[model samples]
Target: MRIKQISVSGLFGIFDHVIPLNMDERITIIHGPNGFGKTAILRILNSFFNSQYSELRAIPFKHFCLGFDDNTSIEIIKNTDNSEEAEKNNIVFKFYQPYSEPVYFYLKPRKIRSDRGFPMMFLDYGIEERHTPIIRSLDIRTEETLFSEEAVEHFNNLSFPNLKSQEEPNWLEQLQSNIHIRLIESQRLLNFVPNRSSRRSAETPSILSTVSAYSDELAKLMQDKFKEYGTISQSLDRTFPVRVVKQQPSTDLTDEQLRHQLNELEATRSRLIEVGLLDKDEDAEFQIQPQDIDESTKNALSVYVQDVEKKLSVFAEIASKIDLLRKIINNKFAYSYKEINFSKEKGFVVTTSYGSSLSNSKTLLPTDLSSGEQHELVLLYELLFKVQPNSLVLIDEPELSLHVGWQVQFLKDLQDITQLADLNILMATHSPDIIQDRWDLTVELKGPHK
Candidate 1:
């Protein structure tokens, strides 16, 4: 989903400010010299979704926790809208608070308290210089947050949703859902947005629903098939009078059964011998020897041979069927972003490209090729192969390990990919080339908010 606006307040080093966004701009380019809050913006994005209020504050409050009194907090506002929302004349978004509200998450810092000459002890929560409870004042419920009920509920389930009512199945855990949806908040980062899994969130339904849903169904079907097959097998085992079974750890063959079987075989041979059914006298020498037989007799041996052959055939057939089924499933959904082909026997030669070729050759890793080829391969995946629409991507630096001449083309391709995926990209870069077009979204990281 696209983000329309992002406002950060009380976050470390960032003053209370609202960053308005334009819908026409999709790529947001944040350009400034190093040591500006460029990296901090990335951190804030991560914190907006991933960090707990207490954990968010802990880094800035470490010294304070150690008796040098200090306190810190963060709040974020995200706005989103889509075609559907536009038609409905409605907008949706989310906000976060530190505590006392139904925060989709809660992460408290581990506090270690060491008093002079006293045994080391750990505090359950933040403590003041006088060793009193600090009682985190962040309210994550109403004041610090807002979002559409449906959207917020979806995110809450994936994130720090509630566990108050045991009756409701935890939707997040049930479906293994992890993504939260939002509309484009601003057009700033649209151009810089690259196509990659890193830019996507867990709310991506196609990614999980396709494979995970199939897996769940497959497991249920297999379980049912096994049950039906086992029921029939059990009935067959009970109906058979002379059924032979493999030796089991708990059960042993009796010598009596073996001896009796051996006698029966010998008796049959002796009768044949008397009747002159035997073709050769040499065959008589191969007669069953009861004295040499232990728990298994000649008759048991014959049964075992027949049983083993039948079991081996059954297992071989089952194995073949299973392998075929697995192959079919893999072929159905095994999508790769890019492919590389390298020859090990030919002095480490390498070839890299994007897309499953017309020949449908397997995709290869980037490292198999030269450095430039590898970067291009990555670019191919980012531009034409993987980026999704209405997603957010944060890039630390887009210009590393690439030629200067390719910068424009790379950005152009990146912009095209964002359009394809309907994505919003936030990039932090030192190069002026990447910033030429995304001037409106470019935020100068004025160091320390001065």
Candidate 2:
């Protein structure tokens, strides 16, 4: 559901205010001076998608609700650590239906660090794969494990509390399992960029320890080879086999272009998983899941499932990788990456054409690029690669360290990404270049969200 407006009071410094959200536009820009609490808005929004509100706990607000366009809203019921029960700091997420009673459910927060139990995994965008799954041991029943009647009953008890019948689907569990990708802020993406792997990143507070091709032993090899050649041919040609992608990003890609992109992404995922670098190999393969359903229920749910499938079709296993490739090809100075290749020995590598053919293209390591260039690559890569359909992305200060020309192109590129994924972005920036002519979608935040 689209957030039509945000109603806040007593949370942080956001006094009594109702900021209307832009449900019409794909991109929403918030322009204001520093200390205007632009980042605070993003933080609170992100905290909802996440199970915790540690930041909001500081404010003893009586009520704070995120009202949706559907007249539905989620009210946050807070529980502090000082409570008598340690596990009482649970998620009391109340979902109110228009003209109907609220649906109350509790997802018990697991104790210990966030990494002890296998939950969800966060994707890293620094040219390497990192599956840092949230720690929470779940009672997962695979087809192999479902043979036991006891295991089947246990799975039902955990996933579907009320629905004891075999015919009903665990709709709640399905919704929880396919949760959209969380907020990825371009401004705070320093924690995920290749530059984050540098010494500077260690000195600063990094959310994710970014790992790139340059951080490994291959940096020396790339430097030595590209010192004169300035191309990826040497670094990627270590093995006998290398797949070359010829399609480059255009202002508007044709049907053939899209097919090539989809195919390239599909191949990369296959090769990456085949070489044991990807963790998604554990996921179940395509199959018509047998469901015990009555004809009435089947007919009613057929249209809904079809709609969901149609929307999901845009997302292949490597949608983000496809986005990265698009960004690399679209941005002229984005390391001149014209074609991408993969080698079992070399891993994923790139060749630069600078608008020429791959054979004549130059190559450079991820470290060879300037900080500004790296920032552009990292920001675009993460947004496109990590965002999911109907996802809400919050970006702060997108013009940070970017060139004037890049700042101008930023809006269009962002729109392209959103269009491809059907997501909404709320970006806070101070640069006029970033705004350009898109003033209609701008939200002016004069401190305290007035």
Taking the tens digit of each residue's C-alpha lDDT, what string does model 1 give over 265-360? 555444433322222352343355657654444444655433323322332322332333333223322332332221212211223334646565
lDDT of 1: 0.38
For model 2, state the Cα shift of residue 422 in Å.
2.0
Q: What are the per-model numbers of colliding residue pairs? A: 39, 8
lDDT of each residue in 1-450, candidate 2, tens digit only: 577666655544344445676787767787776765676666666644442334343344434677766676777665545656745644455677768887765544433344333232221111123422111112232212111222222222122122222221243344333434255555432343212231212222224423243223233432343232323223433321222222222335344443444445446545444432333542222122324334433432333233323323333334444444444435646433444433323533556664545567766555555566656666665565556678777786778778898888888888877776678887878899999998998888654523
TM-score of model 1 vs. true structure: 0.36
Report per-prediction Cα RMSD to one decimal.
23.0, 17.6
RMSD of 2: 17.6
Q: Which ten residues in a row have the lowest lDDT in candidate 1?
A: 61-70
Give candidate 2's total backbone clashes.
8
Cα displacement (Å) at residue 24, model 2: 2.9
Which ranges of candidate 1 are over 4 A from the true structure? 9-18, 51-107, 111-365, 368-373, 379-388, 448-450
Q: Candidate 1, residue 49: CA error in Å?
A: 1.9
